[model samples]
Each structure stands twice: as structure tokens, then as C-alpha cells.
Target: MADTAFEAQGESVEEVFRGATQALLESMANPVTVSGGWERAIERTDVDPSTLLFDWLSEVVYWKDAAGVVFREAPLTLTREGDVWLLRAGLIGAPVDQQTQELHADVKGVTKHRYELKQTGGSWKVIVVLDV
Candidate 1:
């Protein structure tokens, strides 16, 4: 098993979330090889950023585990409705083919251990740990 840890920071919540998705993609395989042959729509709402991040990443892991899909690009939009934050995302990737794409580590799921999401200064920063 392998453990992958990464930190992503951005000026906005959307950028930070996209960075996290990129980190997840990199952990699984080369992003360049992952073409968009399939699509998944992810919608999540949470009261806080940390929980939203965890749910968002867990959704990605769900696709990987259930459908063998690894996302290379995630174009998302975030909105705030009262006290809740809503995320609507379009995920792009193809089904993992062992012979065509080089496999790195199989990420089982996102771990709550060492997971952090915070706003420092004017930027949003997130740290994620993935269990492989």
C-alpha cells in the first residue's frame, strides 16, 4: 500500500478544489494519458470547506472504486446559499485500462487523518491524505 499526501492553495475556493483534484489524478496515473471519454457530475453541499473537500474527494474515489474511472480534469463551480456551500462539478476522464495507461498506486480512499482546509490571508489552502 502507498500513502499520498499533498497540499494545494489558491486565491479562490474553486481553484483550491481544482488543485486537489489534480493532486488526486497525479497520484493515480499520468494526467496526460487520461483523456475525457466519460463524464460524471458531482454535486455536494456542506456547511464548511473541510467537509466539502472530503466529500468531493470521496466522490472521486467512489468513481474509481465503482467504475474504475480516474478523473484528469474537474471543472467546477461553487456557490454559497445562506450558510451552505454548494459545488457543481463536471468530471472528465476515461476508464482505467491497465495495458494502455501506466498504473501508479491504487488509491483506496481519502483519509480523514491529517486532512485540513483553511483560509490563510486571502488564499484557501487544503491538505489531503489518500490511502492506497
Candidate 2:
């Protein structure tokens, strides 16, 4: 599989995170074919946004690697307290089945190289590179 990289931007933090999540799934499979058969809640806390984004994507990759589950939809909420940032995500998708869905690239992990998250002109933008 080839390396897949994409950038996502949104007016709010939640929207950007959601866009990133969708981009990840789309890289692996066609979004139209994947259905929401199961739901998983993921929670992570980090001292900074960059680490939070890395860890969040890493966890999502772990799910695909360990459980054969591919997440298609993510509704996320982010909150900050002091220096710690909390992320709560409700992810919905189904386990991989070759007969049911066509899988594309196998995302090995999320890379920190060139990874960035920032706000520009009142919108949040995130750049992510996935190892496939």
C-alpha cells in the first residue's frame, strides 16, 4: 500500500477532528459501503493538541489492527482544563469482512513528521500523514 496523506479543516475543533477521522476511514475503504453496525467511545487526555491528535489517530489505527473494525463515522467533543485537553469521541463502524466491503490501503500508523494543527482566520486546520 502507498502512503496516504490529507489535510482537513473546519470552523471548530470538533469539526476538524471529525474531518480527520473521516479522512482516515476513507483512506482505508469507501465510506458509502461501510455501515454503522457498532459504536465505540474513545477518550484520551493530553497536555497538548499535537500529542492528542497523534494519540487519537494511533488509537483508531489500533482498533483496525487489533479488532478488524474500521471506523466510518466519528462525533467528537474536545474540552480543555488547565493545560490538559480531553477528547471524547463516539465512533461508529463495522468489522472488516471481505465479502461485505472492499478494503483499500492498510494504514499502519500516523506519522508525526509534518503533522500540524492550527487555527487560521477563525478556522481549524489539521494536516495528517498516514503510514499505509
Candidate 3:
């Protein structure tokens, strides 16, 4: 793949995933933590690598909606098993009460618009547009 796909110049998929997780961590108001859910999920099924990005991100939104927790980090793993596309990841963060926080309308999914991880310099950055 072209190096231009990464946000942190010259980064690989692993690096991009790491950077995106870190960026998500920094954007949160509180510290979010991840459990072993990611590993367990990945081990359980088959999935497409191309679809993993959106599924992984969407899962984050699902957690926020279900638990009201904006994760400080999203540790995602994409692997293929058979013909299925599996997305396994864990989220870390504190839960925000529905009454106290001004919650925006929940995001339905991620958009394909500018959805890329690029490498700039010696690091990676992710540019993602959410589709609500």
C-alpha cells in the first residue's frame, strides 16, 4: 500500500491503529480503559480487514451510546478468518451520566470520506469522518 495512507508519515497499519487509539485517548474528558474484550473478540470469528476500520470505530460509538462512556482508548485488532471480517477491540474510559452530559446525537457509523491513516514524518495519524 502507499505510504500516504497513514497520518503519521511512513507508518504501517499497526502504527496507524496505535496513533488513532492514542488520538481517541487524548480527545476524551476522562481516562478510558480497555479490557481483554478485544483479544477475545478477534479470536472468536472471521472478518475482512477493509471493513475492520469502520466496524471498530462504530463499536466505539456503540459503547458510548450503551454505557455513556467515551473511551480514552480503542485497542483494535483486525484479522481475517475464513470469509468473514472480524473486528475485535476494547475500549477504556469512564462513563458519563446521561443527565449530566450534553450528549450529541449518536453516530450511526463512520464515513468513507477522507477515512485514512497517513504517515507524516516518523509518526502516524488518522483522518476519519464520522457519518451520523
Candidate 4:
């Protein structure tokens, strides 16, 4: 059985992702949010998973910047293999760039920005981001 503790923590993470996704989506309709999200991401350093999150979020922001499309909430999956955890999520918006874009980091490549989530033992984990 899945641990109740993970369920609680996962809910919090989901909320954050949902809010962030919504913020980006809202930006498509309202220019202020788009600019704000972009400005916030720009002000920070491109640090591994941190930057990965920004880039993932930025992709949505970029759409608003380029075209103006809002993405719906996507189901997230978490998986693990040995010591590596894999996170999978379907891209849920009509994005301008269907083509995979190389992240400005050690991330090998974007899996269509899709992810898979999984758990093992008593710990829940996923490939939140990659370092290629």
C-alpha cells in the first residue's frame, strides 16, 4: 500500500505545480502574469532542477510570450529505477514549439517534456528533471 505520508506530500507538490501551471496559463490571457513569471525566472540562476522547473514553467510563459496558449492541468506520474527516479507528465497545452527544445543546462533532452512518476519501498520519487 502507498504510504499516507507520501500522499500528503505529493498533494502539496501537485498544488504547487497546478498553481504554477495556472499562473502561466493565466499569463496567456493577461500580459501581467506572463511578464511577471518571465521576470522572476530571469532574475534567478539556472541551477539544475531549480532552473529545470523554471524552464518547464518558462515554456508555458514563452507560449504566452510568443503565441498565447493556456495549458490544462496534466496528470503527473512518478517512477524509480535503482537510485534514479523518473517523473512523467503529459504536455497539456497548444504550445508553439512542438519540437523539443534543448534546455540551457545539463539536461540531456526533454522527453517531449512528458514525465513518469513512481515509488519504491516507503519513499516516493521521480525524475523531476534531467542532467544530460
lDDT of the candidates, in the order given: 0.85, 0.84, 0.50, 0.36
- Across residues 53-96, which tens digit of lDDT does each residue of candidate 2 receive? 77888888888878788766777888889999899997788988
lDDT of 4 by residue, 17-119 (tens): 4444444443233322221212122222222332344455545444444543334443454334564433455444443333332112122322323243434
lDDT of 2 at 33: 76
State every prediction's TM-score relative to the real structure. 0.92, 0.89, 0.54, 0.35
lDDT of 1 by residue, 29-126 (tens): 88777778999888989999788988988888788878887766888898889999999998888899877776677888899887888889999999
What is the Cα-based lDDT of residue 43 in candidate 3?
Answer: 26
Best by lDDT: 1
Q: Name model 1 segments beyond 4 Å from true.
A: none
By the TM-score metric, which is better: model 1 or model 4?
Answer: 1
In model 1, the clashing pairs are none
Candidate 2's displacement at residue 77, Å, is: 1.1
What is the TM-score of candidate 2? Answer: 0.89
Writing each residue's lDDT as its tens digit, candidate 3 over 22-116 gives 54344343343322222112222334343455456556666666765655455666555578745566565556645543334345555667776
Mark the regions of model 4 whose C-alpha exceeds 4 Å error after superposition.
1-14, 30-48, 65-68, 78-87, 93-132
Cα lDDT for residue 95, candidate 4: 33
lDDT of model 3 at position 72 = 47
List per-candidate RMSD values in Å: 1.6, 1.8, 7.2, 14.3
In TM-score terms, which candidate is top? 1
